[model samples]
Target: MIPQSHPKLHRSEFTLGVLAGGSGIRAGRRDKGLMIAKGRTLLERTLERYGKGFEEVVTCCRDNAWFYSRFSSRVLCDVEPGQGPLQGLSALLAATQTQYLAVIPCDQYSLPLDWFERLSSALSSTVIGVFATDGGTHTPCCVLHRDVHSQVNALLKQGKRSLMALYECEGLAHMAVPGAGMDIDHTDALHGVIRKPPQ
Candidate 1:
């Protein structure tokens, strides 16, 4: 449960953003989110695993908005398709309406149930955002203040599309979340992994 001090953070104030706009060059050019793993699409698994608690969900993808719309509250297509996850992040940030946005990649199927709560708890006057890190930073699995949209746009304008650059610019905080960074980036990884049964 969220601490009482952060009473303003209700489910309505959060929007879950799924980053599904990758070029999938590592996944044999196939849409990684749509790839079937153990009879469910990666997108479905992602939503089921970490999409709880948010009242709204927005998905960013390169194409097939129609299909994504079936599972998302709203679907956004990248303005410049095939760019990268940073472009997807910009699009998601632009479309978010809540005070907080929780982002997770569509291929990240191993996130913890308390992922959003932990990240949200870390946000304060000084920390505008918080990303999960085990040993390495998982930039996508983060919670950001809606105000960070301007910073994201600034990075885009400066031709800096790396998520790390954005995190550094904002001095984002990090929380250790073991297994939160596991993602399926290749066809072989998908076949070797299995989504756990819903709790």
Candidate 2:
């Protein structure tokens, strides 16, 4: 259960969701979210990191329903499995009761807890989404308006998987968060991250 100390924001505002549906091709087919690090599963660590900042928390995954359900009853699956993040986003957009969603991948453990607030403060009527960037490239980490559901669903049906492609098609804005980089896409990468001393 979500702690009572966390403030509840209206669904018309924003909610947090984690995307954990990657194929794990580089991680020897293991579910990255379930990978133990510092004695906690990645999914649990993600929720503990971001859960208090939002009224609700959800996870989007292609499988392991029972595993994710331990953190949130709102666990959802992609509209079509094996497609990519775009498919997972479609399911999240459809399921979200909030006006906006701030997304972070399950593998992104170092994303600051203030992420949603930082991106949200940058929102305006003209912008439908705000993507967090590191250096010059935009990471999958982003915040999106709920109204884009239909457009996202349409693109998923058309077989679009690249997020940068969708961002260009939608004309979304970007926000740079220094030191924010995605590092764990494979087994070696995950090992490199966990073994490193916390700064």
Best by lDDT: 1
How close is every model to the real structure, measured as TM-score? Answer: 0.90, 0.84
Worst 10-residue stretch by lDDT in candidate 1?
A: 2-11
Q: Write model 2 residue lDDT over 1-199, tens digit each, in one string.
A: 9543423333236667788888788888878889877788877766666556577677898779888888774898765668887887777777888888878788776666576767666666667788888888667687888877777777877878777767775647788875357646676665544443233
CA lDDT of each prediction against the hidden true structure = 0.80, 0.73
Model 2: lDDT of residue 66: 88
Model 1, residue 11: C-alpha shift (Å)? 3.3
TM-score, model 2 to reference: 0.84
Clashing pairs in 1: none
Model 1: runs farther than 4 Å from truth?
1-5, 191-199
Question: What is the clash count for each candidate, in the order shown?
Answer: 0, 0
The per-prediction CA RMSD against the true structure, in angstroms, equals 3.3, 6.6
